[model samples]
Target: MSEPLLSIHDFSVTYDVDPPVHAVKGVTLELARGEILGLAGESGCGKTTLAYGVQRLLKAPAVITNGSVMFHDASGEDVDINALGAEEMRRFRWDKISMVFQGAMNSLNPVAQIGSQLEDVFEVHRPEMTPRQRRSEVADLLELVRVGAQRARSFPHELSGGMRQRVMIAMALALRPQLMVMDEPTTALDVLVQREIIRQISQLRHEFGFSVIFITHDLPLLLEITDRIAIMREGEIVEVGRAEQIWTDPQDAYTRTLLSSFPRLTGERGVVVR
Candidate 1:
């Protein structure tokens, strides 16, 4: 495998309450440069928590109790993400790593134009760029995600669910970060649209040379898109292996169960026999 872009070791997160809830427990995973790593598990299995913890986006009441997140920069510098200060982390995000949040399509500002929202990324991260340059970049980003530049003027509600999802993807790609953490990006979209989004993501990853941590509960979907699959259960990774190996022969009972939970359609195409 190529050099690891991100190395996470002994990571844990907890919600401090009357009795602390250990949301994530000692996760140790690595993402190879330019490779897609799928994190699969049932809902509430700490998949999202791990993503948020890695990015340092967890808020009050939730704390990183242990572990280290090491980001290997392209420049050959190793960054200890857990050690970054507030200002440093603020700048680190969107530049080194970006997140295409779960249901992010629905999270877009309803009143804001798509172009404006896209430009906002540049405004914060690339402030030195001229207004004209930002506008041009925004248009380019939209096109990169297969969303027409003309739709940049449309509000979030004006676009279809798929289009809005594409817009979110465009935003995530705006900075061309080395890594992207996508949490259930295809949720709520129809199967066709979901497939399209997945295809776009794979193509974009190839073209942009960025690594992706694709988090989802769909083991079958992960098998199709990811190079490696890590199965998480109750705040821990139960198994990790090549996608094909995981599908053909999962060592962990939990992984096998997950794969079996999704029914497969066999026999004639376009014909459903109940």
Candidate 2:
């Protein structure tokens, strides 16, 4: 196997409250350079918490008690994510890693045009580029996500839910970061739109060769698209294995229970849709 692009070792996160709640417990995981890893669990199971912790995006009250996140950069430099200062972390984020946050499409500026919103990513990260260049890049990004460049002049409220989601994805892909963490990206969309989004994500990964950490409660969806699936329960990883293995023979009771909770399709088992 190729060396891991990102590594999380003995990671733990705690919510400081009356009798603290341990959100994540000593979770150790790794992402291969160009592989898509799915993080599946029920609501409040710490999937998002773990993702936020890895990127040091957690605020006070939610603290990282222990652990380390190491990034093996393509430039042959190993980055200690936890040790980076404010400025360093800021520079490291979009340039190396980016996140397609849950409800990210809905999070776009309502008054701003779609193109300008995409251009903001370049404005912040690639400030050296001229305004004309940024606009050109924005058009390219929109087209890449399958969102028509004509929509660039439209506002957030003007686009469909899937189109907005695609725009958000385009923004995440703007810098071509090595790894993109997507948390419940398909939520609130209709089944058809959800399938389209998943297809786009899989195609984008193949086209750009960027690693993805897809987090969601949808086990079957993960089974369809991910190379490997990691099942989380109460902040701990109960099972980790190849998507086929997990679908065919899950060792953990929790994993089996999760699989059983969903209705099975007729004919075959362990078949990957993507």
Candidate 3:
């Protein structure tokens, strides 16, 4: 197997409150380079919290009390991301790793043109690029997500839900980060739109060779796209296995229950395990 591109060793998180709420337990996981790993769990299961912790996006009242996040970059240098300083982390965020926030379609600025929003990423990360270069880059990015260049002049409110989500994805990929952390990237879209966005992500992954840590509660979608699945519950990962093994022979009762919660498209309920 290839060396782990990202490693979590006994990581834990807590929210400050009366007696404190443990949002994540000691969870050790690994992601190989260019692999799509799914984090499956219901809401409040610490899936997002874990992703936030890895990216050092946790704000006040939430603390990482234990463990470390080791990120091995393409240059073969490994660094404990949790230990980086503010300046170092600023450089690390988009250049080496980028995150697509939950409900990201709604995260775009309604007042700004889509092309301007896309250009902002380059402005902040690649300031050396001239104005003409940034505009050209923005056009290329729009084409990459299959959003035609004509829509670049349109505002966020002018695009459909899936197109907006694609714009968000284009911005995240602008820096060409080694790892992309997608937190419920397909949420709120209709079934068909969700499928299209998922398909686009898979194709982009194949073409770009970037790894993804895809977080979502949708088990069926994860099984369809991810190479491996990690089942999380109550802030803990209960089972981790390959997609086929997880679907056919879940090792945990919770995993089985999760699989049973989703109705299959062929009018079969138990076929995932068959």
Clashes of each: 0, 0, 0
Report the C-alpha displacement of residue 26, candidate 3, in angstroms. 0.4
Q: Which stretches of candidate 2 lie over 4 Å from their true place?
A: 267-274
Models sorted by lDDT, best on top: 2, 1, 3
C-alpha TM-scores of all predictions: 0.96, 0.96, 0.96
Tens digits of lDDT, candidate 3, 82-102:
889999999899888998999
Index of the highest-lDDT prediction: 2
Expressed as tens digits, the lDDT of each residue in 126-217 for candidate 1 is 98999999999998998888889888899999999999999999998898899999999997899999999999999998898999999998
Candidate 2 lDDT tens digits, 1-274:
5779999999999999989999999999988999999999999999999999999999989999999999999898999999999999999997789999999989999999999989999999999999999999999999998998888999999999999999999999999999999999998799999999999998989898899999999898899899999999999999999999999999999999999888666855554545
For candidate 3, give the lDDT of residue 159: 95
> Which residue runs of candidate 3 sit more than 4 Å off their true CA positions?
267-274
Which 10-residue span in candidate 2 carries the lowest summed lDDT?
265-274
